[model samples]
Target: MTFKIALIGCGGMGRRHAHGYIELRKYFDTVEMAAVCDVHHDVAGTVAAEIGEATGSTPDIYTDFDEMLGDADLDGIAIVTSTPMHHRFAIKAMEAGLHVITEKPMGLTLKACRQMREVAKKTGMVLAVAENYRRDPMNRLTRALIEAGAIGTPYFALDIGVGSSDGAVMHSTVWRAKKEQAGGAPLDAGVHNADMLIYLLGGVDSVFAEIAINESQRTLRPMNEVAPVLAEMYNHRREDGYDTGDIVEQTAVDTAFAVIRFKSGAIGQLIMTDTSHGQSLGVSTVSGSSGTMYRPRSRSGESPRIVRGDGTEIMGDALLDLVPGFELDDTLSTLWNGARHISSYDMDFRDIDSKILAYEYLDMVQAAESGRQPEVGPQEGMDALALAYALMESGVSKTPVTVEDVAEGRVSEFQDEVDAEMGI
Candidate 1:
């Protein structure tokens, strides 16, 4: 009925969760954010203030999570900190008898993710990873068409990321630049697409990747500071407030190509290039026996128009069409936030509640308690990682890779490289 929440990382995402709660509070008669925790007291205090502003207010800000947990009557926690700390905090929150919804990719490794999942089960709490792309409006429509038998049993699929991996994607990010904080593109950027791939195409059975770092992707500063001129436009931002971000080095990649085989008799291929740019649909191409979907562009207007396949040619808001509760918004609920508010949403199908994402993750903790499907399982995270780890390995070898290969072997070489740099 009522949920008391705690925020573990008071970064942008932590604040975003607060914003979501604020929006939900205006309409739902259920939840409230109770407290927030961050390493930086200033950031934590500021976000806590923002949450109160949204929902009347009940949040207490704390610099340390343990202190916040100790002091508050918390019911659930949102772990939105850096990737490295996800496993630890998830465990802490579970042990404290609170539900948790975590940011995705689970943790730094499959082992850690598994451990966190186990604890939630033992503690009778919820553990759901925040893989939000699966819920994207565009992506939601795409999934609906596939499920509606629009795409009959997907056989072949392609994930393409063009122009998207540009500098814009890397803004306000340092962890991704350093392999220590980020697992490079395959893990950092591809994870979203990869997880979505799994969501649409079933499970991945194999992988092959060609990974390369771009030496040219480096940022440059004048060797001479006094009377020195800014060589690149990025210099002004760095000099003013950027984190010494002279792409001083291209630690990760300029481009990457990948192929994935899904266990559901489906094949998936992915292409990603930092230097390359363009636009495509659905992040890639999804081809099935029934039809094919061109993810980005809807469909050409014709008798048998080609949006993706040759059979259906229609352009409309598939997003508004497939959702269940979407149509009930204006009739059943109160619409206050904006046009998209549940009350005013004129969707046709049952709207997928993002609230489910939070609840399901908490369900992981609850399943840990009651034993059932918490939104999804811990294995889903592992499978996603295993597929990515395999792709990274294939990229290095310039050979076709299998997800089973990763399941069978250790990626110590790549991991060691990242770990050594991390001083782990």
Candidate 2:
């Protein structure tokens, strides 16, 4: 059966989603993009036309999401709206009896995630959060290895990256600088690492985090308790709103590092930064009893497979970078099959088709709706937020907080590694 998809929001990320849906048409039976929605008529209208040109079928466009929900008869709405509006759009879609695939963090709080889950139950629809990193092909291989005990007993791991957006020049995504909307680097970027980390090691058992923001706050305005504007952005100025050089204040942290304890008795480290003075994007290294695998900005592992225990060298290919999709083709295909598509893999952009994983997550929701087990459902999102919130609480109170303690403790930690790294 072809899934009739309605895309909400057609900004940069939304456009990418449009392309993914079109690509899936070849693999699946049908993936008809029935409609598109965005408050900015120009953005939505333009994207709809672009997609029509690409897919040979024009999708209905909407200026308001509610109206779209009322008339579009969509299978599900892929929400790519701002942070503040997520709760509104998501609940609204679920209430309309359509399944929902929403952008991440679920909401600002664990309570919000629960509210979404309840809505899903009451409305009898599905709600899937998009955390694309967990679906990368090589990452899938890593998960398989860990599950197969190739990594022995999982213990400690580190996440690292350095790229154009992942490294310096991060401010390019200006919305991220504002707290009311973007949710900082942790929510914007680090959360990807956080979610992937949990999937591999299991849900967090405990977390410790600390956050800090030190810069001119003069460039922003609160957006009606939702998402405000980054007015202090040099080009975007406000009149008499903020004194020059004043710091914009939100619950967001400019830099954060966190440590998570997982169900598998393994601990994980996550760090994200918007300010890279002399540094590069980091790498992720998972160290286990058997061996360790290191992945860099656009690559992972060494050329020829190195020797392991019993002095036996595993001589494989002396490969290039091993990111996701295209770059890691030789490995993922060798593991899966030759069914890999050569198009999306050539960009060297790490996990180019994290969308597949995102869709698989959506598939998990469909399963939950069917009364089957959901791989990563609302409970998982709530669990992640709970751990992050707990870590923040621990940092502020100068104590350790267990994962079971998040619902009771809601102060919400904004940074990690800062408590120990900064010793505050």
Candidate 3:
């Protein structure tokens, strides 16, 4: 039952995925890292050595994906590439007779996500999206509490993700800020926010979003000491083949604010920005008819507060103590165990998140063994992307767009541009 997996892309996220594979072997059953692939041979070699040292197994390294697929005997491929290439990589892996797991926003476009889903259906391969945030403990706990009536009859919610990535120091400045590859922070991180909303609340009925580019490459850091040559060399290209500079002409929206109506008749608001002068973390709240749940900070271990309409307030460890009798569903149980692992790992959120990623691999293995779909299956990934695309459409049309509209191809604002750029 050992699943031999090969990893594609050896960047920052790929390193974490490699670590996840190592830990999956330690914590779960047999899950072996067979090979690592990246266009940058040095990066791939470095990651392979690191995994070898960590797991005592030297995984084969390759610079090309096709070489890895053609030679390595892999049961699945973990795609850590950028958003636009998700479908291409996934379809290739599935078509090669291997299961696939991909990082989010599923794919850059809804069309791409559907293509992946259709390919999986035709090939009978299991495809899962690595939505680690949905696997976060607090997210699952919140969902459980709402379902258990701890938050009473849920009616409305607010989720906010405000951060400054336009600054040169931010990791996302390279690609996530671009329109063609990532569709800005709204499509990049916004999909996660929207997915969290859908996971906790329910399917979204409609979305009204306003997207804007408040900061057109406002430099937060002066690369004075560093040579411009080094900076320019590392600056990377945008979707339009232009250099991102101190005064870079950024086309993607640095800010997005959206109002969402769930199919269950609940309403919610989502705000995301990667270009705020003084950026804030993910501060979210979900309000019900009788009480409200609030997460003041975005980090994994931060506890949420619950306040009742009658002024009863519960927070922190006390909240857990009060919910001693809460029932545990399968998903909630897995999240609880995952949360416990986070606490046990000395508050390393990166390690904790990586552990969840490991669990995602385990989900894929389970799907393969049982002939069932993965927990975060293609449809769920598609639904999340559909909401994200709908939000973008709403932003462009200055009106509300239904989830079905986007799911059914009634509205598309950015997909064609992405498709053409990707030559799909």
Candidate 4:
């Protein structure tokens, strides 16, 4: 009973998803890679070959999405396309009688998000978003601790991220730097930050943000002098440390700071930047009435810890000891050093971004088979996007924008541009 699935987009993220599918197919016994499609035939063929090598199934490759959809006997389509094409692909695939799971930020606009959600409802198909960050073990642990009152009556937290993308190959692209395509770094990274807020805290009521293009088209002296420093900051190392091109101009708001007012009366201060040097983007701290919980900057390396207001440490050993004989493959497992670790602390968690995608893929496929919705549905993705757009609107208007405004279509210019561009 292997569920046949096709993957769309053959970029960096696409490859990661393919790799996950190959790995999960061995474990799940419920899904199979059927086809790989990209705008470029060679890229699709290349990914198809990789899938073949891993899954022993060489998927058919296609450059045109419609031709692939029409030809393949796929039960679902996993879309990892760029931001602009997400809505287009998801709508068409759902309309064509296929379940859809798309990469995050759901769609560029609230209108587009609603459209996709409506189509899924009408078609009675599974519509899910591959927001791996929400499935990250540390995040789940943090949420569990908060709910357990380790962080009693959560009030405030910091969502801070600072790192230079200058030498990162993914950030050097045009889609990441342009507003029309991806909404730049704000939407690209901010959506994950926003989702964490909602997942742990609650829905955002409003957001007041200040977005800046600080490092716009700046020239560096030379790579030879700063290669070592650049390598440390970006986490990507090479002999020369200069593969992302000499001259880089970022058109998006690379630096953004926002104040999110949660519907539950909690507050979150979000700080994200691609211009900062020698820092990690994943560091987050949540504070409440009684104690605080902190998630480390690196997911694969560190586990989250909680500290009481009186300075009592909730040790990892004690937490792990609380949940004995817990199955690592159970829903209550968290990623610890690339392995599943069970603890009362995490409750149950997941990891490895692609593995998260595989989990979501399996969920969508199972849901399509059983007539249930995925655990992480498109509405959650839309809510996250609402906060993202509110940040942008607040930044542009120099004031706070209510999530309701963005959710109800009061916020329209940027989304309008996206819809017009995509003919949505």
Candidate 5:
């Protein structure tokens, strides 16, 4: 039985998800895109046309989500809307007896995440977070190696990246610059880093952080200079009046430095900034008693390297030897064309990205069908969000904050405004 799913929020990411459904069909014929919905009819119509052209199946388009939910005849829905709407739509869909997979950060705030989780529990609907980073093959291999003791007795990790956005808005979306809409990179892209760290290492205990907005103003990159995809998205936002001008007064924090303590007794330092002036820096390495493992940025398809205390290095196909039984699971193997041991993939950004999202879709569908949890279910999603929020929450009070406290809504100074604004 093919699982019928509909796409909500037909924006840039929504279009990518539509393409993901197209890609999923190449491997598994167990799902179909039944409908598309957006606040803007033209946007939904355009995406519907694209899906039809690519998959030979046109989806019905709707401007109202309730109308689509009532009339689409879908078994599930993919919530690709903005961050604030994630929990709102997921709860409504799940309460309406449909499974939901929403884009991260799972909810507007911890309170919102809890509300969504409660609805899922009461409705028994499968709710998954569309986190694509940990789904990368390289990340899978890194997790396997860590579990196999290749980097024995892990103790600490450093994940740092500093760069200058030069006043350009991220993704050309104005909402991302608004604190009430997004908590900047620390809550936007940082969630991916948080989830990957948790997947590779373990649960985080507490975080002490300093967060700041180094730049309060941003401008749009020239259309010709930006990628075609982003340029098109910017045009759509402008047409829809979501972003009116090239300049945006950013209200979100753009820089963060945090020290994390893991429940496994491992420590981590996370530093992220998009307001640096001159030189840029990046580092991602996990140190253990025996060796240091170098990790590439997630979804980059780059190979991870390990350097032993004796100065010996292992990488590429040789790294697979560290774990004799290392292999992708049956589903991932099928999605990756039966590759068992792969250090890296030879696909472009869009191709690999869509493939990863397709795997996510398949995971959600199978979990809903089998009455199990998706790989990144509500719990995992909430954990990652809590980790990300720990940074902001700690920064707010100028003190270390426990992840548990953040997740349980015991410490929420940073998120209070957003939660209040969202009325959650």
Candidate 6:
């Protein structure tokens, strides 16, 4: 029995999700794109046409979400709207008796996440977060290696990414610059990092952070000046109110430095910034009693390297051999084309991205059909968001905040304004 799912918010991320559905059909016949909806009818029509061309079935299109919910015969809905709309759409769909798979960060604030989780619990619907980073095979391998003593009782990790956007709005989308809408990179892209850290290391205990907004004004970077892949992505973006000529006043914090303590007695230093001019830095590594394992950026399809105290390095197939019985699960193996012990993939960004997202769709559908929770369910989503929010809350209060407190809504100075604005 195939599940019917609808696509909501047919902008850039939504279009990518449409491709994910098309890719899901290549491996599994478990779900179909039944409808597409957006505030902009033209954007929704474009995505519907693309899905139709690729899948041989055209989905019904609607400009209004409520109309789609009432008219479309959908078992689930994929919420690909802006960050602020994630919880609103997910709660509405779940209340309408449909499962939901929404983009990362779960909700605009911890309170919003709590409300969505409550609704999911009450409705018995599968609410999955589209966190693709942990689905990468490389990350899976890294987890296995850590579990197998390759890192020998991990003690600390460093996840740092510093670069300059040169005053260009991220993804050329105006909402990302607004704190009320996107919560900047720390909450936008940082949630992925937060989720991956929890996936690789363990639960976070507390966080002490300093957040800053180094750039107050942002403009669209010329197509020629941006990276080819990003430029291609920007070209597909059709946000309702965005214009190339308009300048965005950034309200979200673009830089953050945090120190984290893990529940397993490990410590971590996380630094993320997009305003470091004249210098670029990137680091992702976990250190332990015996050795240090260097990790590649998630979904990059790169191999992880481990360097022992004796200066010996292990990588590629050798790394796989270190973990006895280390292999991808049946679903992930099928998605990666039966490569089990392989360390890296040779596919481009779009190929791997779509496959991962396709896995997310399949996971959500299977969970709904079986009356089980998706792998990244509400609790996991809430934890990741809590860790990200712990950073913001710590920054706002100028004190270390426990992840548990943040997740439980005990500490929420940073999110109070956002919650008030949304009336949550």
Models sorted by lDDT, best on top: 6, 5, 3, 4, 1, 2
What digit string (tens of lDDT, one per residue) describes model 2 on residues 1-424? 6567788867656765665665454344445789998887777877788678867888998988878888886777788776556667888887776777777776555555666778987886777776666555445555555565554677788874433222211233344665545456665666567667776778777777665554424243232212222212122212234543334444455566677777778888776665554566666766678766543322222221322346553322222223232333332443223435321233323124434533543464455447553445576666655655564566576666676666433443533232222222
Candidate 5 structure quality by residue, lDDT tens digits, 1-424: 9899999988878878877777888888899998999898888888899889988899999989988888888899999888888988898899899999999888988999999999999999999999998888999999899899999999999998887776777666677788898657777888888998899899999999999988898885644353454454334433235433467788988889999999999999999888877868888889998999999777688899999999999999999888888888887878787887899877766777778889999999999999999999989999999999899999989999999999999999989999888887
Q: Candidate 1 or 3, higher TM-score? A: 3
Candidate number of the best lDDT: 6
> Candidate 4 regions off by >4 Å?
166-170, 218-249, 277-282, 320-351
Q: Spell out the clash pairs found in candidate 5.
A: none
Looking at model 3, residue 270 earns an lDDT score of 87
The residue-level lDDT of candidate 1 at 311 comes to: 57
What is the TM-score of each predicted model, taking all chains together? 0.76, 0.75, 0.88, 0.86, 0.96, 0.98
The residue ranges of model 3 lying beyond 4 angstroms of the native Cα positions read 169-173, 218-248, 279-281, 296-299, 317-346
TM-score of 1: 0.76
For model 5, how many clashes? 0
**Best of the candidates, TM-score:** 6
Model 6, CA-based lDDT: 0.88
**lDDT value for model 2:** 0.57
Please give, for residues 220-319, the per-residue lDDT of candidate 1 as tens digits. Answer: 3232331122122122222223334356344655467776778887877887655554653335677777667666421111111115455555445443
lDDT (Cα, tens digit) per residue for candidate 3, span 92-193: 999999999899878878878878889999999999998877666656556767777888778998888887654543342446556777657777777887
**Could you tell me the C-alpha RMSD of candidate 1 in Å?**
7.2
Q: How close is candidate 4 to the true structure, as a TM-score?
A: 0.86
| Pairs in steric clash, model 6 | none
* Model 6: per-residue Cα lDDT over 1-424, one tens digit each: 8899998888878888987888888998889899999888888888899999998999999989999999999899999988888999999999999999999879898899999999999999999999989999999999999988998999999999897777887767778888888557777888988998899999999999999999988886554464456455446557556567668899988999999999999999989888888888989999999999999888789999999999999988889789868888888889899888788888889888899999999989889988888999999999999998888899999999999999999999888988888888
What stretches of model 5 exceed 4 Å from their correct place? 222-239, 242-245
Candidate 3: residue 404 lDDT (0-100): 83
Compared to the true structure, candidate 2 yields what TM-score?
0.75
Query: Which window of ten consecutive residues has the lowest lDDT sum in model 6?
Result: 226-235
Give the TM-score comparing model 6 with the true structure, all chains together.
0.98
True-vs-predicted CA distance for residue 228, candidate 6, Å: 3.1
